[model samples]
Target: MDIIRTISKGTDLGGKDPDHIVELCNEVVQEGHSVLIFCSSRKGCESTARHISKFLKKFSVNPQNDDNEFSSIISALDALRRSPAGLDPILEETLPSGVAYHHAGLTVEEREVVETCYRKGLVRVLTATSTLAAGVNLPARRVIFRQPRIGRDFIDGTRYKQMAGRAGRTGIDSKGESILICRPEEIKRIVGLLNESCPPLNSCLSEDKNGMTHAILEVVAGGIVQTANDIHRYVRCTLLNSTKPFQDVVKSAQDSLRWLCHRKFLEWNEDTKLYSTSPLGRAAFGSSLSPDESLVILLQFFITLIIFEATAFNLVEILLLL
Candidate 1:
């Protein structure tokens, strides 16, 4: 994936920005290549898509665009247009030229429709949030990142790799190209990132799992919460779980509890159906660790010992279970 750092107008001077973005996209897209642009938010995604679609439409004509491909795209959009309030004004105008935007704010059905068209090669240009970058396996000839930060958090190297990985379609694309439209200030960092290799995957279960585990322990230890219900209440206050139903949140907590018990970090009393942290659990808690992470570290250490002393395949069996 090619990471292109846009100069002058992109980030250093704010107002003249995005217009230059549209201009750049115009130059790339008109050459018959599709571009997937990742904006910072859902609103930015919508706005960017609309802006580019409008500019492209001056050269776009209905009922004829050289083939039947566009006709299929229009029909897909028309179905949305005819439903309820129909397509948004932005989508209604843009979809005619095989362009659209995607983000989490839209309904599942709405997202499915847009994604289907893009996959069918009916949608040529797409503006989307980083959600699209991580959630699906959609590839485009070119990827243009309009911003480095999404909301308050900067996109990290792992995420950059994940998003850029969407660039080339296997067999279909000779090679995928990705562009990072950043200010001159961000150029060095972005270039340094390009030279680095990706580290091993850490299954960060929804934004700082280890941190959340420690926070939850703090809440419990501080006497702020005495029951699973209280734990669920606080967890629901978090951004990741805020929109999730309380029942779902509680179920997840319960699963974590069971996992802790299985890890020998917590004791579950069958007769009373009560749960309490064991010595290991308390030790892990004091050190700011989740039972799962602690188990992983312990396993790694044990494997090292076994590599020098043990003759049994116990480590292999344990790894298989994990």
Candidate 2:
């Protein structure tokens, strides 16, 4: 997706001025096209939507036709009122002007109403958090980023592409455009992001993320791995091994195995140099529990069992002493 770059004299936090954003939406809506504005936070989404809605209402832009027998905007408003969240005050103000914001902070019912309205063209301008880009199919003629960052950190290439992809729906719009509102100091960074390639794929089983512990436990418990040699062989074939140094991969695997043994999740025979899953490990593997999860569950179970035994046997005094 191609981005039409724009610079802004922004706030201290580096986001574009909300008034400028409202005017941009005004221009897009006047041309009879929908616009999607991506904001960094849920609060930002609501604030930006309020700004655009007020502007649209003041100028009577994109107003719903009068005397419609069944107006979707009215229907959406009714739906929100009946919902558990009871017509979000922001939505109550904005939906009448064909504007709304979407984010996780809204109840499921609220988000559904906003999404349906936008899709049916009842809502002309939508402001939303970055999650809307990744999770929803709502597209627009023009996509605008209120800020380059989703939160405090700058958005990466993949996320930018995801949000930008929402522009220019396949059959509806003949052309799609993406605009990034950045401060002067951020121009170089934004340009680099526009040119950056997607980051390389990494294994979910990488030790750095603690996935190695789960992987090693599963293999050994399932009898797929028998010894340290078998672990080294297994490690050599994984995606983690491909990206990391051979020695590092083996060391990580060995460390995970040792950890499992130390936690009594696995047993190792010094003479045979073989590894086997303990009863706890077998139970954990069978239940599809992670090593840490299994430990917590076991501890909780034993605590409950001890309490029950003490109470049933009338040994509360002895229990306390021990």
Candidate 3:
């Protein structure tokens, strides 16, 4: 697969021309190839897609006066026809063509619909968050990254290698093109990272196995376990095999359980020999209720309402008034 990596350091599109990116995307789409643009977050992805869509629409309708007119009006019209009807009423009214937004915040059915459209070649461009990078196998002829840095840290040489690796799909494209929009300095760094070989993948299997083992002993000791004991037992019996020193494993597990109890992450009852959820433990287990929510609930339970004027009244003054 052919990979093309571009770098831009400018933080905002206003600093650099957005039309250049949109034009490149149009060119790729006109060649009957799909494109995927990655942004940092859901909001960023949506905003970028919206901006690009507006530019594309303006380009398609007024091609001569317009800067971006690689694709014909007919193609744009076709794209509009294939767009999701569930979009906001205003957006549905003024439908744009050849582009769509995809992210996790969208409903499962909505995501599935976008995937189906993209796979069928009905949708030419997809702008999404990096969530699509790891799991989904969607192959785009061209992949554009608006921002390559992960969070506050500048993407180091190693990170650049991983991001670039997502470019080429094994069998889909003869060569895949990956583009990164960054400043001139960042571009140089990316080039250096690309020249070096990527490091070997780190294995987390050992850590996960140890964690499961610890969880099992914690459950038996009547302490809260992050995951269910049945899951750990299944992993140990079926996947890990009983090859390790059982006594040592048991001792480590017990130690971990005791530590958890001491930390108030879990509570231990010697008499009942059963693990019960503490207030903190319940908050941890219940996905619907967050720690903040639990705190709010507790506060509401203990605190009674007071009149605004009560603060001005001393104990003797309040008693005299009563």
Clash tally, candidates in order: 1, 0, 12
Better of 2 and 3 by TM-score: 2
lDDT per residue as tens, model 3, 1-322: 2454443544242234553677767677666787788777777767766666665523233346233332333344444445563444322322245566777776665566567666756566788776676677678888887786654556666655555555567777777887777876676776775677767543222334445333443343343343445334534543223545554444555555555556454666677554555666455445444333445665675564344345546776978989
TM-score of each: 0.55, 0.61, 0.51
- Model 1 residue 257 distance off true place after TM-score fit, in angstroms: 16
Local distance difference test, candidate 2: 0.83
Each candidate's lDDT (Cα)?
Answer: 0.70, 0.83, 0.57
- Best first by TM-score, ranked: 2, 1, 3
Question: Candidate 1 deviates by what RMSD?
Answer: 19.7
Q: List residue ranges in candidate 2 displaced over 4 A.
A: 1-19, 57-66, 201-322
The residue ranges of model 1 lying beyond 4 angstroms of the native Cα positions read 1-19, 57-67, 82-85, 202-322
- Which candidate number has the best lDDT? 2
Candidate 2 residue-wise lDDT, 112-223, digit = tens: 8988988877788999888887778898989999899998879999999989988887898888889888887999899899999988788987755799999999999878
Off by over 4 Å in 3: 1-19, 57-96, 157-163, 207-322
Model 1 collision count? 1
